[model samples]
Target: MPPYKEGRERMKRKHSVWMMILVALMAVSLIGCGTTQSNLENKDTAKPAGKITIGFSVSTLNNPFFVTLKDGADKAAKAAGADLVVVDAGDNTAKQISDIEDLIQKKVSVLLINPTDSAAVVSAVESANKANIPVITVDRASNGGKVVSHIASDNVKGGSMAADYILKTLGDKGNIVELQGIAGTSAARDRGQGFHNVVDGKAGVKVVASQPADFDRAKGLKVMENILQGNKNIQAVFAHNDEMALGALSAIQAAGKNNILVVGFDATDDAVKAVKDGKMAATVAQKPDLIGKTALETALKVAKGEKVAASIPVELQLITK
Candidate 1:
């Protein structure tokens, strides 16, 4: 073979190798660009302004009813892929106020509250309003100020229902005692009014004793025991909540009085069982789960700049044997 021809062939081979390397480099760059674009598209699709956070302030998680309410809210929040931060006020109005302040500082997207006291929560609501955060009241109300919505049962009507049941069961003639809830609570006031409305003019139906039990079973028991010591002829006891009614039951049993009828509100599981066993005459059932779900939904709507009604009324169930 000739030397020049051999050298030209070698040069051609080198050029071919270089061309191959260049093509490989271009292919690698194109693949990298495609991967980057894919990642960008995935990010855009996965996050639509990220997730929302909701703050839930409950009056007391100590009660089974409130626990149910919280559970419902948590389930709904999880389904919506939203974050929920729950705080318990321990039935303290001051602590509830502080909890609301903390939620505001955290800059939560929305606020769901079950106030300890409606009047005491107004300041917190106003503060949230000033910060442009929507507030939804659940199972309670704020005394004054702007609240996006209130999700609760009609206490007045529930009270009336309870009163009617008591009257019918007693045959419109009996000596009764009233175990009220928390002093300042709307439930206590409204329910008491309802009972009074039904029993006021009825002949032979007398209110022998009345006292605030603070919606605590132990308190109710103590109050009832004291009343029984003074008035042995009490024919019935109406309690603002099941806890109080159960307490009254204990007191009545201790006094060896099995004839007195007991009516309660907030038909908790225990209350239902009591009714089933004939330990309680009747109970008014409030749907805590529905209240929680509705409050969260309303809060979301308000957060999204939608108009929500001031009050969302829930249904009541009359539970009796």
Candidate 2:
């Protein structure tokens, strides 16, 4: 009797051990499954599964023109069901170059750049080219690089329009001042060329003084103040951008000067209001918003390996009071 009871006790103990082992194994398996599910959920929620991202490197956000451009790009990107990442270079060429590198590393589908300086941005553009990322330049162009496309207004024509307005207002016989944009930019170079083409050989319309205002309002004001100290008989002023034109107008007003015709480009909202108020004689309107939208559209096409124009020109208009 004692031997049979002992055998029964041994069997019960073995059964208990087997049940405990099975429970432990199941617990581990459940935990592993939960971990996997959590990881998948986290990954799915963090980002869209197949959304394409576009990188936009802006020269400066301080300018209203660039802000408008960014707005247009953002709207277009949203409408196209694409993601956008924007970085402002703050008018620093080196920063812009670094920003482009960062975007390249992110593996963006496309890059939209508004260069701070044309020649200086070539290296950045080339980096994108080497990485096989399509780049579409907006507003300003790189002097050297294989860009898919460039979107901007006909700045040369705009400058000539300003010159014509100045000559018509001043009778083509008055001394003038020119406030230029940032050096090494296509906008400034082309605009300056067009202005000079009209005024360089014109009779009695001398360029008494010309200076680089760096497309900045503060710099324009300071430069105009200095120019006024030397040139007292200036009859008209042409600025490559509206910011500089407004700054020049401020200087003219502060110096108690009046009736000096001032012309500007970009036709920013403030500049348009100034023209309507008679503070500025006229401004060439380059639809910055439209240019930005066109840039994004072209970038999307390029990312899809589609053909796009090498140069896309936006229309320009002259606004006068």
Candidate 3:
């Protein structure tokens, strides 16, 4: 072969080899970029695992008062961009404990509890604390536990106010039956104490029978019926809640009893209507809507590691004809 032709052929061969190497490098770079983009898209589409979950445990949903509380809480939770899970204990202590356990298993971020029994709920509160979930007590206090906050009305003063209204209406002389709420609830205990304190030294007044109606209107009616079987001369009835007071009214009217004063706690809308209609003498109004709003607000603050007061007090009003 000629020397010029051979040299030209060798140069062409080197050029082809360099071109092949560049193509291989470009192919690898494209694959790497595709893989990285896929990974980033998967990461962006995946749902975040941890969100703020709040467990709201209430004593019962049977009453309208609690229904209002739940409504207020739902509104606040939505406003704060948090999730809320509500559990009703139905005034049963065991059920309340079970509900708390369920919330813990869900790994809720916080607990807002209105205990069935203040003393019985302490262990459940401790369990929440162990899981690092802050517990906020609403409308009541846990017997003994590290609670983040307590939101409740002034029950003691409200109870005393109701008692004084009854006394003045009855001329401080009457045989009254006390219809209490769930036995161990803080509201029930404190309100009962306040009522007794006011009527203790008063003359010509007696609490003939005191019974727990479990804060249910049906139970209150039945219990009042039983009480009326022997004590038809009863002049007044003081119920711990409007439902019980309404129940007492049913029994009173059914048994042809008239001119009996009926005073109640929790000035629910129905209770106010009854007072206007001359069925109930008075009621102590505890703002349940306010309690629910405060509880949720406090829970959000706690989740954010913000400072919250130990106690948030709600006001009480007296409603009567």
Candidate 4:
């Protein structure tokens, strides 16, 4: 072959090799870009950071009061753009403790508890405390634990008013059957103390029977029925809550007794209506909806590391026909 032809062929081969190298570099760059794009999309779709979540543990929703309370909390959470997790303990303390633990594992930003039994719920509160979640108790309080805030009505004052009304109606001297709430709860204890503080001092007045109905309407009915069997001269009834009061009212009606004055606390819708209808003598009004809404708002503030009042007392009043 000629020398010129051989030189030209070598130059052509060198050009092909350079072109192949450039093509390989371009392919690797395209693959790297695709991998980075996929990773970014996965990160975006994953759980969002810094989203506020609240947990509410209720004693029970069997009664209308707690149902109304939960409704208020739901509305407040929706308004504040926070996620809420509500657990019902069915008026059982052990169940409540477990529910709280599950909520803590979920990493909630705050916890709101309406304890079934005050003394039994302390360990649940402590666990949440260890998880670094602030706790706000509503309606009922824990006997022991660290709580950021407590929101409820002044039960002692309300109880006093109920007792005074009974005293005036019964002429300060009569046999009264007291229907109490769940034992060991703050509401039951405080309300009972306030009532006895007034009634116990009256020499002519006598407490014929005192029993716990667990703040349940059916239990109240049965207990009152049994009390009526043993005491025929009972002049009045004072229940710690409206559910029990309403239950006691049922017993009174069933026994064909109309003159017995019945008073109750927590003026729920049904209780208010009964008061209006002359079925109940009186009831202390408690704004459960306000309590629920306020609790959630306070929890949000607490999650932001803001200081809140130790006790936030809602207003109370007596409702009568």
lDDT of each: 0.88, 0.94, 0.90, 0.92
* Best-fitting candidate, scored by lDDT: 2
TM-score of 1: 0.83
Ranking by TM-score: 2, 4, 3, 1
Q: What is the lDDT of residue 70 in candidate 1?
A: 93
Model 2 over residues 30-110: C-alpha lDDT tens digits? 999999999999998776766789999999999999999999999999999999899999999999999999999999999
Model 3 quality (TM-score) = 0.84
Q: lDDT tens string, model 1, 148-256?
A: 7789988878878887888888888889999998877777787898888888888988998889998889999999999999997988999988889999999999999
Relative to the unseen true structure, what is the C-alpha lDDT of residue 306 in candidate 2, on a scale of 0 to 100?
Answer: 88
Which regions in candidate 4 have their CA more than 4 angstroms from the true location?
Answer: 1-50
User: Each model's TM-score, in the order given?
Assistant: 0.83, 0.91, 0.84, 0.87
What lDDT tens digits, residue by residue, belong to model 4 across residues 44-135?
A: 87656667899999999998889888889889999988898999999988999999999999989999999998899999999998999899
Write candidate 3's Cα lDDT for 131-157 as tens digits.
Answer: 989999999799987898999998888
RMSD of each: 7.1, 2.6, 5.7, 4.3
Candidate 3: regions farther than 4 A off: 1-51
Give lDDT: candidate 3, residue 313.
Answer: 90
1 versus 3: better TM-score goes to: 3
